[model samples]
Target: MTQATAQTRAFVTGFIPAIALLATVAPAHADLKICNRMSYVVEAAIGIDDKAATATRGWFRIDPAMCRVVLQGPLTADRILLNARALGVYGSSPIPQNGSDTLCIAPNDFVIAAARQCRQGQTAAPFTQITPTQADDGNQVAYLAEDSEYDDEQARLAGIQRLLVIAGYDAAPIDGVDGPKTQAALAAFLKSRGLSPEIVQSPNFFATMIDAVQAPSSTGLTWCNDTPHKVMAAVGTDDGKTVTSRGWYGIDPGKCLHPDVTGQPRQIFSFAEAVDADNRTIRLKDKPLNWGGATQLCTRESKFEINEQGDCGTRGLAATGFAAVDMSGGGKTLRFAMP
Candidate 1:
């Protein structure tokens, strides 16, 4: 998603427009920059196809309403690809803002000169080809927006709305505009934290909100990464009538996340695997490392919500083991470990 005014690029930060800095105060050399106009902080990877070869590098963390120069130096690529993912704060990874070209990426920050194949430790994801609007100074700029088509201010509000929902508040629309619903939710959130409403606009608000979302909740299920490596997890729920599954929530070491689930389900299912820095599933004792049980469900490599559990492979999904989560009491905690 790209948007810019005719002669100038539209963008972010308080009181100061990002484009102003680019136009008036840029470095001597031309560069590639991406501005976040989305509701969540995002980690972006770029794929450059120049000459006859392609390369991909990534995990550039851009906060809401912020911009980062991804590729420095003069541009040489005929084609550019992007795969921007919302931070893990949303529980299940949100559908990546990506493109058609499948490319290899590492779990950690990396530079892959040959982006075609996935070596042992790397994983592949579709990258969207982008044509950044070229500035007069020869720099290229791109924007990442949610479905709402947010501007800098709207993106910040939408980001707050998302975090509010994650923290168990009842914010609505998530469309950046401040309305009754958002105001009410904000008031409640501030009150619950025993914080002054003044803190809402402060720089520390996101930090406070992040802590709230990461903390355990009294309802639903939480997955904790107790392992040394990162763990990707999925959850499924059954209410007797229907069984739905979704997955690929990346949990960082020692942190916890609560996958968003709805309604009171009769059963809950869980599956997770520990992965090394390059996004490869770890192997131990010559076995694929994973945490699961006998029950199997359909899952794909990317972020997905599966409504059907049968004939997974035929539907272009992988059938993976899922253990029945014992939710006899209200909320439950599932820990992923190296074992």
Candidate 2:
């Protein structure tokens, strides 16, 4: 099989469903969308005061009109805290890269701060700080009551399976639980795309995968950001100095604007020599080439040739000569041609 096909297969084998549940419940509304924008999803908890409270399993919605924290879940407990760092809602600090030093904030601190502000009839802060010890406190663990409703794992599995299939993976039917078959398919797909299969199993896997697929191309030959207005050349002068310009011959007004010329058309020419910044004249590579001279060089050298309009051209040569025929402006440095 070809390399592309092999990688595609590997990506399909290692897929896994992401977890959507969190320990803390937020208010019910439409404006609040969960932002799990990180590369890794993490499990967290919410605590009210020093006590751990069980929360309902549902999404949070923040409504600017009502300005209230509405709770919608299996459990109707009014006093609670929310803990779901994976959603990027509540966290102590930015997630760490190589270690866990930044994941020190506890859910309890957030809950207490919210409660205190609410009771005092003051607006609650967006986030609050929690200590490591308070984060580990068992009292902050909330338990779901018998009446509390939660999302079915089976439904989640089905949704994940459907998404995988849509992403071009041939995964099995949705089962609430993860299985070796699903893992194999995920692995195949990740490998094909040049990503780590092991990371795909993590909570942030889907986020990372989406980022990679949506990233812009980085090839230097293409214009920046794939815009059509830009053009680039790899030509160099004979003195080992490379000249890159935005448009044809680095002479278009839109391509280059110097004090020397106002609106010069793009054209290529051969020069006898060029003057440097210190006013020293430097000889160019080829003799002053008219259309005939350029055509002659094109025939003599197997690699050297004249392109359209009889401009000197070279194939695989390290350097080239560039000249501007119009010396309209007084700038001496810009008037000369360089080899």
Candidate 3:
């Protein structure tokens, strides 16, 4: 995900640890488990304190109805921290399950020290101190729950529905209850992927669905990050009538993401910039690594979808150039590469 270019650090004397908890009771051991009891598929980061020094690591993916052992071995940590966010495939980012302890994290999978303040190319976010219920003062479980309060089956179903929608299927009202719509969407997805109907019960189904949603389709706009660093992008559309701009889609190196651009807009525009591990715009000889064009559009430092095209500064938005795309063909793919 495109990390907001903000960073800060403050060591807290009181710390806590969080990991994915197991749905079923885990075997007692000196280990930690993270279980996903929420509706949304989430990725989590964690921090650990071993009485001497604190270390942070993560970007662990946990699907609904599932649990993973993120930390193995002796559980001697006095305090720990966790930060979790929904998958970006869902149009806008879902409000994260967070706490008040602000900590540093990298844009991608990482493991770093928690002592020094974050340096360049790093961003800081508030992490919640999660204490898993312990058993025999040994094994522990941390359950990830949300307001939805979905049970195991419901969370699994809802997670599937969420991914179906992102994959451009027509499943809605993700209430976790199975209905004809959910079934039809599943059938269609299976047929398209040449997957067997029985695969629906496969252990890797969610991961498979995740893979399907990120591939560049031949029918819409796609952004591919071919650079060494992470790239963030925005899109503008004109339907021969009203025009709109939206963005901040984070594209990791070597990955392709199809932004939610629905319907056939007469014209499409795009803008992108590559940033380093610290979230700073990468520069080559003082020039920032970027892609854009002559079509100017209003944007902001945060996530935005602006329509009013005039006097952007007056409206507290920065006007940025967006390049028009030649989508004369059915689908178009924009690739970002280093010079």
Q: Pick the TM-score winner.
A: 3
| Residues 44-159, model 2: lDDT tens digits | 33333334332222223211111112222322233433333222111111221121111112212223333332332122221222221111312222221111122334333443
Per-model TM-score versus the true fold: 0.75, 0.24, 0.81
Task: List runs of model 1 lying over 4 Å from the truth.
Answer: 1-31, 48-55, 72-80, 91-104, 113-120, 124-126, 134-140, 191-196, 278-280, 286-288, 294-296, 300-302, 310-321, 326-329
Displacement of residue 88 (Cα, Å) in model 3 is 4.8
For 282-336, candidate 3 gives per-residue lDDT tens digits of 7789888899999989977666678778899999888899999998998888889
Least accurate 10 contiguous residues by lDDT in model 2: 219-228
How many pairs in model 3 have backbone atoms within 3 A of each other, for residues 3 or more apart or on separate chains, i.e. clashes?
A: 13
Among all candidates shown, the one with the greatest lDDT: 1
Order of quality (TM-score): 3, 1, 2
